[model samples]
Target: MDLILRCLIFSLLHQSLYSKPYNIDGLLENGTGAIESLAKPLQDISTKDYSWAKGNQTCSQLLKDCKEFLDLLPSSSSWMLKPVLALGFLQVGCLTEQEPFFLDLIKDKNARTLFNIMAEQTNNSIHPTTTNSHKSQPDIQKHDLLRFNLESLSIDAQSISHHMHCSEIQQEQQDVLLKGSILRSHSSLQHAMDHCDRVGPVCAGVTSDTLGQFKSVARNGGYIIPHVGSKLWLHHCTAGLLRRRSTDPECHSEKELRIHNVMQWIPVVSGYYNAGSAIYYATQGCTAQAEDRAIDASIDLGYDALFTATGGVSGAVSAGVGMAVKPPLRDGVKSAINYFKAQWSG
Candidate 1:
């Protein structure tokens, strides 16, 4: 071996020289002084960002640590430990192309070292009847390293999922607020329809029935409300068109009747009759049933109100993030659910 390669081998053997089944813990049974000692130099070297000059130094140090650790292991330990070792070397190799001379220490040896071990472990684990627990010899160090790599990947995936979820909720909130504003505007029109007298026919272009059409428009916009605790105002052409009834002042009936403009019913009815243009298109369908429309409108409005409120809370957390973060927090919750489906299958 070259002088550089020899030093690296010595560093690895320093950790395993004391044990046979290549017991990592048994080697450190009294204390973890040896592994720490090996890791410290590498850690110090790693702190410097890898570049052509610094990168070479760090790679050399890391290679020394990895090789010495590998050479000290018994033949049997290498069989089980190779895959994880290979993966670690793969990570190091990735680090190298980015740094080139930076990985000088283990540049040549890293992959070969890991691949050889991985091939050995693959051979040992392939027997159809082999039981994991019943394996001839257990190599804890290799098992531990493999677990570490898997855990690192898992953590990254989970972080992405969380960020995506937060973004979805914020979007849902904005949608709800937008829909609610539309509903409130519609409510004001409904108020006008109830209190204003008719200028012409019941379905006159700008008459009371115009409010009914607004309800239908709201539905097409994705608002859906449940049946619970719904409130709506009903409007209909009643039979008592001309008769005026005397109200007892003590009963305070005038206040209740004030919405109808009892004094000017004749003029109000005439305005609906002669209006030059229609305010809204008449639904050829039985469209005058304002109460029903109100109920449906109210339902849609409620849906929008609730949706935005809840969605807003969700969206603010994840807004402006990637689409990955937005959907689950709002209407895209179904998509988020699909992600879980894949996870569950795995």
Candidate 2:
């Protein structure tokens, strides 16, 4: 009996030593279960009909449901669990009618804890720690982790879209879909902007400024881009010009330089033209292109005015020359120009 016991102990130790370290399946199952539990309260809040007469009562019920749902969230810090937590936050935020109540609930200690968890998880996911331990791991493990995170994000995003009834939710879903595609293609920031442009003005309106900041940072070698609003306009114009050059061969040829010179000589000339045309169309009850032209004119006028104040004719000419060049230094040069423009605007 002593000999049998000794043999059994040896077998158990060997098995333990060779076992797999990570439990991918277990984590996925736990995530799914947590999502299901959290989803129930959100669904109830979304589908119920509340009359204005019962507004206060409805608000109270909404807060109760949100608080309970938040309380049910698991406290695990595993990166795998972030997706469901993100989904819960998104669902609660989409409750536009209960905004006031929802705002109040976030003040609770428990609600703040969950929000901090999500924010910390997001930061860690974006800039993962690279310690000695992480360095020792195989590349395959890192790849698998990334793939798992993206898969989980996609799944939870779909779930949020299906259950939430808001335009903002739909926009978030579209952003997730675009991000996945952008990752697969391994394209530059400019390419991502192009994708947004192709998705139509709604997508562009939503993502343009953010993408512009990203592009500016990338072009500046990871430095923060300056100017809150002016850089945004310059980036928008640069992206528009880049897109135009890509789609229209004429914009790339030597002939385009002449047109660029014309615009350079008469600062804000195109701004005046576009603004006049916008006013004409607006008076005639035409809306489609009128609004777009008006926006363009505003950007042009702003760009010219800001640059003229800071660097005068030289600045305006330099900016025009920068945009007229080919794609090599387009983003970097434009960013530099905007930096000066931003300094003056401030």
In candidate 1, what are the lDDT values of residues 83-146, reduced to their tens digit?
2333333333424333433344223332233233222322222212222342211112111111
lDDT of 1 at 161: 20
Residue 198 displacement in candidate 1 (angstroms): 56
On residues 91-187, what C-alpha lDDT tens digit does candidate 2 reach at each position? 3333442455444544333233333322332222221122333221222221122222222222122222223222211111111111111211213
Worst 10 residues of 1 by lDDT: 273-282
Clashes of each: 33, 0
Candidate 1 residue runs with Cα over 4 Å from true position: 1-22, 31-346
TM-score of each: 0.15, 0.16
